[model samples]
Target: MRDTASPAPERRGGHPVATRAAARLDRLPPSRWHRRITLVVGIGAFFDLYEIFLGGVLAAVLAAQWNLGHTARSWVIAAGFLGMFAGANVLSVLADRLGRRRMFLVNLGAYSLFSLASAFAPNLSWLLALRFLAGVGLGAELVLVDTYLAEFLPRAVRGRYLAYAYTFGFVGVPVAALLGARLVAGHQLLGLDGWRWLLIAGALGAGFLQVMRRQLPESPRWLVVQGRDAEARRIVAGIEERVAAETGQTLPSVPEAENVPERRVPLGEMFRGDYRRRTLMWWVFQVLQTVGYYGFGSLAPVVLTAKGYTVTDSLLYAALGYCGYPIGSALSIPLIDRIERRTLIIAAALGIAACGLAFGFAAAPWAIVAFGFLLTVCSNVFSNAFHVYQTEIFPTGLRSSAIGIAYALSRLTSAVLPFVALTVLTDLGAAVVFAGSAVLMVLLCLDVALLGPRSTGRSLERI
Candidate 1:
């Protein structure tokens, strides 16, 4: 499970200290330091997804309990996504301009408080408002995790490690699904609805993680970008010492740092020159991919209910299917760094398109379970590939902002997709909704195949 860093002969960055810090990181083998960081950050990601999918799980039950129409149901779900749009677009830029660790904790704290408040909401409007505010905190979390990992992890294992973090994080999906299936209708504990208990659990869990994450060191690469070479060097040296002690292996010598042009790329740099095409491709991919991913993912329980399954049956089926989120992510860990990220993305997306279509028409319980499992597995592989891909293609200066802006649009799609998918399912059927999903996945596959950059086994700066 250990990997010795074999840094490239030459690397590029804004400062020589940052370049050397990156090289030193690349030379250390995988150790407790990487795992600790990955696990710590993964916990935050777990809550992010738990909160995201909890909305869908709650939608059907709340609709029934409150006599919510389709429009009202859509608003309930869309509220969080709308907040995510603002948080991601705004805080992501601040991560780049400010420090990654600062914004990371800030967003986590914001959501944890609001999510707990949401559990006590007196009405639908209060619940929606709290969810929106909590979502603002949820938005920048994953973005920062990605930025942090891509900066610190050795290039040799970067893709796989990110997959590893997400594998643990994706476990939240199944946990949420299972909780929804069991608790959404059960007797109230502590004089609260079962649904309210779910929110409280997520909020409390994230709050604990926020405290644990204070031990995380800021990204030395980011520190260098801020012209704080002494601090960057100290942090990198401390990490190297810890990794060396844990691995008990003689570290390889840090490769000679190459001096590339050191000017900080402007925030607008993503829209110009070589980056423009990448930016456009990311934007388009974000929009279309959300329709395929969240369309089925965030709305599966409701879609099942719309298909005539009872709330219990729908949640149970969703729980079974959501198991694939972690399974699929785990499966990707071995192949993620080995395969070209774009190729993996294209292949998994195609699998999603096919499995989604099959799941749409499946009637037998066995068939439903089979296709749902396959679809989830494929989607996680697709997710793992793209999550790593997006971080790799952008440099340190533009990574957070570019990803934030691009991801914000996906939140927009996620916000509206419920209404769109629900409208389609109501007007036509589940089959049509999935048919549309298939088309969107195919379009996304084509987009990546055509425009996505090759980022396999490459350093962040080189890409």
Candidate 2:
């Protein structure tokens, strides 16, 4: 239970709430619970990614089941993103005001229930409406998970830990793709369409996890902001004890009232000075990168089929593309803390451009597969690196809101790209589509590299 007796803990040394939380976490060991928290959060994130990728996986199946054209399928896939944009932007402010843990649980429950409803949709319109509603929950869940992890983990291990969690989380993409392929590749079950079964299974799986997540504690830092230092101390002490027993090292001393001065952050301060610039840069980067990234991945099968591959071959090829997610996640671990985030992001973006061009122009099937894999690898690298970068840039007081705003823009841009890609590629050809994406990547990379700060290895307060 949250402590109700003490005055809210003061923000230490004028640092943001998250930075203070990060500092406190530095005192603990990297223990089983620590790893478990990371894993559980990743699991939750996996379901989030599952929902995002499921739309793409179901598109081909939906087309066949409904006898719809490419345009209609594109709209269905885009609807989720449209819903996500609204959720991220609207709920993020509430996260700051109401509290992270509260909002997190609400988002999870909301999405899970709506997703379950989607499984029973009688027609395309019903399915699309349910998907959009579920997407709002999904959008908030993604932002909250990132914020929660960043707050709870120590800075020393934040990059690598987050990388591992995200890598494993994204492994859900391949899981969803492979499962959808196998299930839908055959006859329907229980007289319900195979595609409907896929939706039901995913919804039920996510709902189960949300139920389990109630065991999770709220962020101690949020408690501190509400003037519950004693409660915050109790939670931190438990974590420290567990970590010490697991790692066989004494936990470092937490700074006490005698050792450090107190500070507080007013909500309106984010709009002043350098923070405003940083916020704008993140928003722009997210919007452009998402468009380039999702536009390619969401349409991978369609693009491949357009190049003359059979349906089985296209699905297999798309699976190969999905594999790049985990690989990219794993590869980013070592580089995340070692390299400048700005540099890594720029390189990843340029690599995406090169791979996109290569994929568009490749005539041979093997060459297309190879280039598609490379593109996904680079795209994930850019994505994971930015995920860490953006969260680390803001203070705890506004972290969720900032991330939510930026993430919302990304979803908005992504929502439009599928329709745009379908329309443009129809008349302009795959080469032009790929080439246009390449140009966007290059320009966005330059903008971020030149304007964005180097965030790796820095304390959140310093950032």
Candidate 3:
């Protein structure tokens, strides 16, 4: 077992209270309280992915309704990505400044409110605009959740707990797929178009989350860094009481930790030291990873339609493929803490690339679904693994902003990639499109494997 006596080199010129608060937070073991936190936070993530995956399925239906060509179809899919790009970069900077709990609620409200408006869109342009607005919340919500989980969870089982949270989030993938399958079958409900009904479902779920989130406690670590030591101490004390009651054991003494100063961290700090190299690495990974992951996800149904599947049949198959997401996350739960995080990310990426090659060549229904399922499974494993890895490497102060910028690149590339992928699919073929995905995955594997930090057993301060 790794020793906890020394987490990192002690820093000078730091507040004692901030150090004490960080120590208290880093000392707790897993409990029902943590599970509750995950459930509450993870549910919002459900709607984020729900709106995204559901939008992909709706692309074809909307295109048919508007008599849009392939390029317009690509725009229908890309617009939300564009909005997400802006949201991740702009709103995430505020998360570290404003507090995770407050931003979580605000982002949720943006997502839920806009999704409701999206259902009422009278023209293609209105739908695209509303979805773009909704995408903003989706973008911020994802990075903040990763930031929250990393801070709240201790280093020992951090990856596993994160995997569990994402496993809950991944459950939405299958739920979205099942919902897509249902809408394709039912056609409509409450006199609205079937696609509009899908948007309503995401909106209602997010609305309920806003009410549920009121009970959530703010991050003690965040409170400390902001010089609100009294509040941070009170929060940790309550957590200690609950943990003690659950475990029926007195908690061990917390190791001494150096204070993480409460100060204004400029956005430019990321490009200034070792963080500069780290930032560049994630930027490259995010750009390439998005092309392989979302490129296939958002455009797969459209390609299938062009290959002669009816709209309903294409959605049914896509829904089945989406099931792989949760299954992949589930598989990672045990191995996440046990294996090296970068190792898993690299391995999963290669598996996904290999699966992509097969998916492009497969023509039979069973073969196509089989390859797609395999691809999504491997893709999500990489996703859950890296989400934990990314948050762990950065300081609490820089965590949200770092990921915000990285996720923006992920979304930005995804926004522009649809046009590229569709053009390739339209001219060259499905094989070429997926072959392109394979090449990007290879690049991602090299970037992460060579440059990513080892974080599983190290404290956040040490990492």
| Candidate closest to the true structure, highest TM-score | 1
Ranking by lDDT: 1, 3, 2
Q: Write the per-residue lDDT of candidate 1 for residues 196-312, one digit (tens) a residue.
A: 989999999998999998999998888878887778777877887788788888788766645543335688899899899999999999999998887777998988898788898
- The deviation in Å at residue 363 for candidate 1 is 1.4
lDDT of 2 at 64: 63
Off by over 4 Å in 2: 1-22, 254-268
Highest lDDT: give the candidate number. Answer: 1
Give me the runs in candidate 1 sitting further than 4 Å from their true place.
1-15, 261-263
Residue 342, model 1, lDDT: 91
Q: Taking the tens digit of each residue's C-alpha lDDT, what string does model 3 give over 1-463?
A: 4323222332435545656666666788778888888878877778877766665677777766667887778878887888889889888888888998888888889988998999999988898899999998788888988888777776777788788878788777667656665776447777887778878888888989899998888887778678776787677778888877887776767776655454446788889888888888899999998877777677778878877888777877877887898899889988888888899999999998999899888888898899999999998888888988898777777789999999999888888888888888889999998898899899998998777888777777767
* TM-scores, each model vs. reference: 0.96, 0.92, 0.94
- Kindly indicate the candidate among 1 and 2 with the higher TM-score: 1
Candidate 3, residue 102: the lDDT equals 86
Query: What lDDT does the true structure give each of the candidates?
Result: 0.87, 0.77, 0.81
